[model samples]
Target: MTARPVSQHAAGTLEQALAMLAPPGLLVGCRRIETGDASHILPGESATILSRAAAARDASGAGRWLARRLLRQLGYGDLAIPRGKAGEPLWPAGVVGSIAHDADFAIAVVAPSETMRGVGVDIEPALPLPPELEPLVLNSRDRLEGCDVAIAGKIAFAVKEAAYKASFPLDGEVLGFEDIAVDLPAGTVTLSNGRRVGVGMSISSHIFALAFVPAGVS
Candidate 1:
């Protein structure tokens, strides 16, 4: 899909909103996708391994663009983040990060491994979750106090996705939605494995969720 034009001010606003959700020691960023955004793709970052479709490549490039910038702040220069076997971004040693995008925007977060074990981020439009998927994405244990009724399910969905991404490298196991219990009011998610991940969210411009595992956690 072609990316719609987004004003730089709007992009910056989203980034600012997301920054509030970021914990100490992590860098977060977001940007609007543009035409031929795939040009940001660099050598050593394999697009073919990701997908041949131009749009997919463009989105990947946008995510890496943000990731590289974030990594640079942590004393690293430009580097390649290749796709792992399980379709996750392979960060440099001593660094943990995650990237995600919807059709219009791309986002990334990175932190030193000393401070964080893993970090996951996701961006989604501020839209309601489809009715058919609600039962699958939300569970009795999940809580959404103070969240708007219209987009509550969508926020929960984003939180679960980010939580799964944050936990996978640590646990080495795939998880179903049933395996995660989200508590929006508490800003956390608990995996069936008993790992608790801290959750942060931004509702401006888009629904942005960040999930993180602290360094000393099991």
Candidate 2:
């Protein structure tokens, strides 16, 4: 059977992008923008781009552009844009979140109501990892021993990316691949700092992870 394609845009009309991007149970609102035309509309907030070597200028710029647009869409009114000590994008007062952009696409997740303390989202195209680098990233001694190193690496990369996003607001620390461990099935993450974050996965042909922590937590 063929797999379903991931929907790039949030559900509902263009006006509802904020509502659709906002995950349930969180006080914030989120929206996904794919076109360059939307760039001018973005309000406050800084943007970070994560693109492949081949990503076009327009596509790469979309990540930061979309972030600004989403902040304005949610009524943040000219964001105060700050960067964490590790260079992670920091939102203005009363707002906390992260943004990630890849070769073909970009995504911005934000909180309007601030109910959610911190949020992160990451996506990786379904592809095999290089053979040489697999062993370095995988935890071979663990139950992952039997799995293909390429697959393990892909999962590890996705989880770490998600963790990086989730960790942005708690501190400005830059987390290396070795800084966090992911238990895919359990949807949990343990950071080197000893902080635990909750994880959510969107599995399709490609894999995406959304990691978050309640505002009340450190």
Error of 2 at 6 (Å): 12
Q: Which segments of model 2 are wrong by more than 4 Å? A: 1-57, 78-85, 140-150
Residue 185 displacement (Å), model 1: 1.6
Q: Which stretches of candidate 1 lie over 4 Å from their true place?
A: 1-3
**lDDT of residue 209 for candidate 2:** 63
The best candidate in terms of lDDT: 1
lDDT by residue for model 1 over 97-173, one digit each (tens)? 99999987888999999999988988889999999999999999999898889999999999999999999989988
- Show pairs that collide, candidate 1: none
Quote the positional error of residue 192 for candidate 2 in Å. 1.7
Candidate 1 achieves a global lDDT of 0.89
Query: Looking at candidate 2, what is the lDDT of residue 142?
Result: 22
